[model samples]
Target: MHNLRRIRKHLGITQKALGDGIGCTQGNVYHYERGQTLLPEMAGRLIAYAARDFGLVLTYDHIYGSAQLPPVAMAEVVNRG
Candidate 1:
């Protein structure tokens, strides 16, 4: 499971705000945060948009454990970008 809700909240952003920034709806954000949906590609986009638009940097280690899976690595690239 991903800690997207926790991390986004820790970054001081509401679900709606995160959704708005990522071109998705709040329900989609909820699904992502709750692990009901798995949008790995969108997750990368969201992470990048969060850092570039909201100045919130979320590393792969923050969301997933240090497993270094392909998706997690992409998330790292998004976080760094």
Candidate 2:
């Protein structure tokens, strides 16, 4: 969980910043980063945006402690829109 937060911080983005990018609230970002909740779709969007926009390779292991988020493709599509 701490690692997750560290990654977000490493990106030089505040919770509010991230939320703004993803159409969420800062409190929601805090909850997700802190492991208080799991938002699979939003997490995938964030990872995809980070990778495509910021050159950050945030795999599922980094974001969700698993290597099985298939939402990357969907994220890409959404990003294009």
Candidate 2 TM-score over all chains jointly: 0.66
Kindly report which residue stretches of model 1 are placed more than 4 angstroms away from their true locations once superposed: 66-81
What digit string (tens of lDDT, one per residue) describes model 2 on residues 1-81? 424576566566677867777778899878877677656787678777677656667776877664433323444434434
How does residue 75 of candidate 2 score in lDDT?
46
Q: How much does each candidate deviate from the true structure in C-alpha RMSD?
A: 7.8, 7.6
lDDT values for all models: 0.66, 0.65
Give the clashing pairs for model 2: none
Backbone clash count for every predicted candidate, in the order shown? 0, 0
* Candidate 2 structure lDDT: 0.65
After TM-score superposition, the amount by which residue 10's alpha carbon in candidate 2 deviates from its true location, in angstroms, is 1.3
Against the hidden true structure, what lDDT does model 1 obtain? 0.66
